[model samples]
Target: MTAVSDRRPAAADPAVAGQAAEEDLRSLFGQSTAVYASLAGPSHVVHTANPAFLATIGEERARTGVPIAEMMPELADQGFLALLDQVYRTGEPYTGRDVRIVLSPGPHAREAFFDFTYEPRRDAGGDVTGIRVIGVETTQVKHAQRLMTEHRALLEQIARQAPLTEVLDGMARCIENLAPQEVLVSVLLADPDGRHLRHGAAPSLPDFYNQAIDGIATGEGVGSCGTAAHRRQPVIVTDIATDPFWADFRHLAEQAGLAACWSTPILAVDGGLLGTFAMYHRTPRIPQETDLALARVFAGTAALAIECHHSEQARQAAEARARAAHDELARAVRAERELRAEAEQRAAAAAELAARMRAAAAAQAAKPHPERCQLGGSPGCTAPAEVKIADSWGDSAWGCLAHAEEAIISVRSVFIASEELGGLAAYLDR
Candidate 1:
């Protein structure tokens, strides 16, 4: 009879045997988690694959009796098929870690990463017969790492108070880059009253498209962004071509090659609107879970940047107002000082005028007790001198009431003498 079996291993220590058993279990169960497939011949024909392989490459595309390159043409341009060719020709195992691969390769293409190994299979004759592919999908892990890195960078930018425009532009580019499918990002800042929106950032969109939508009103049926702002909620327009909200801008959307737009209103903690964040798609499509998650995350980031900018502006305005008030107060103080000085000068001049008038009256009293008019013009007055007047220079004159009153009014420093009032009082007594 033929030998049924002849396989044996050297005995090991107890600890070594236990470790070996654990390794064997790991190898069996861990490989099941991976995608496995076997290709036959130099052409790398797909002979068989597990469910994981079928799921990864698409159930419809997975088939036997076809070259792997023919089954997945997108792999040819991405250097994967070349690596396979090299492994098949050399009969050497090829292993790749975190290898990036593009699937589908078109508008609907997606990026994926795999940690995989291609081991060459050999017969009893030591001739290479086929190749075995064992791979584990690392796409989720890779994407998670990238998302964390990009998010951390954005947070750092915000913490350092970068310019709003720079932050917004970087955020837009980051979302566009991170999205699995093609998406355009737009951020529109709201007016202080939230009645209108001004363009903030739209790097991937056409200039014409951005210009056309700038200064759009925030109201119902205005557009996706406008409606979202009006309602303080998200607005998703899956098909802009048929949506009544886009009635006025259908032609514009067509020109811009946008068929769907989803907008989320960015609001402050107190419910005040800050702005709107939007995502546009070329084809009419509904948002997936991942898409909505991304929008929510970045919308909050945009809100932070916008709020910080507004706070800075408000602080600057308040500082300016304080400075202006201080200047006004200083001016008022200087004006008060000038007015007080002018009043003091007027008081001193009046005091000097009064002193000279008193001295003039005393001199006049000593000069003459005029019986008749001694204070006349060139022709002497026969009428009685009834009143006495004196000027700032102490020059005195006695004349009738009319002429004395005229002289007092005509000259700046002329005044009625105290001696004349005494004379009039004596005359009245007599």
Candidate 2:
């Protein structure tokens, strides 16, 4: 009698229906890259979850038969757990587009976006028993969009010829904000000769650290950035504390709490050194392909900025030299004009003096014998006229020794004169 029709129909059994619903949901999303999870019972224990779901919540919470809240305590504070509860009790499905959440909240937390749905699962009696979560992470899409916007802005800055330092600093900040993990971005500018690197930007690095490495030389074993620059290639130091390249800077890296550094050399189109772009991490870790790609992209940007800066400096230098040359030529022309004017004045003065001497000589021609010195001005000299001086225009004067010497030295064309004296030599002979 107890065995009579004891088995119930599969549709009537709540457990069977629940199992079928879970299978259907899994079959739809299990193989997909999209995240999928099914919670069971009023407690909303994680009954089944795909790899994407486990990865999204973190692998540490991958176990089933545990309440979602306990498995992902961080989600409770983020309001995700409450949403799950609401869907379970109200039997309503909720869909969210571009929902933002911070995973593993703390200093190491990361922001993630998702397009997701929370559909309540009903049993055979139409009673809501659990919630099924299906989600696709939009974090990369969002990050890519942001990266494009920031990259465009940087190009604009370069196009407008913003200061290199300003562009580099902004780029460092942008990369720091863009990276999913905490990263310190630094750019070092190469010297004109490419023998050393100067600090271009490091907004996230400690001031003391930045100053210490401000002008590190480019050479082998000179830390990641310097070595990268010297080799003209990328350098990846996964463990700064142990890498030979970091031997000289190990203590500094330790003090700065840096464990890893990846650097890519920025080069000009002609293969000249521009600078280095570096990403420093607090933990020792290898860089992925994506990380390398990011470095290359920004290194090119740094090159563009540095090249623009150098071109502008060269143009300014040339303009300054041209201006100086123009100024010097103008000064020379003005000086030449002034010299010609002064020469003409001297010539005119000499001509007038000659004419005055000739008039004086004509007045004195009447006297043949000596009197006082004729060249003596103001108070007359009582010395006998011992010398006769004449001008080039046949003007003659009689003077004592001192007056004759004075006249010969001061007058432009004065000379000794007499029938027996041919020049100053004849007067001296006498």
Top candidate on lDDT is 2
lDDT of each: 0.84, 0.86
Q: Candidate 2: lDDT over CA atoms? A: 0.86
lDDT, candidate 1, 232-288, per-residue tens = 999999999999999999999999999999999999878899999999999999999
C-alpha lDDT of residue 75 in model 2 = 87
Window of ten residues with lowest summed lDDT in model 2: 421-430
Q: Give me the displacement of residue 348 in model 1, in angstroms.
A: 4.2
TM-score on alpha carbons, each prediction = 0.80, 0.85
Listing every candidate in turn, what is its Cα RMSD in Å to the true structure after a full C-alpha superposition? 7.2, 6.1
- How displaced is residue 377 in candidate 1, in Å? 6.7
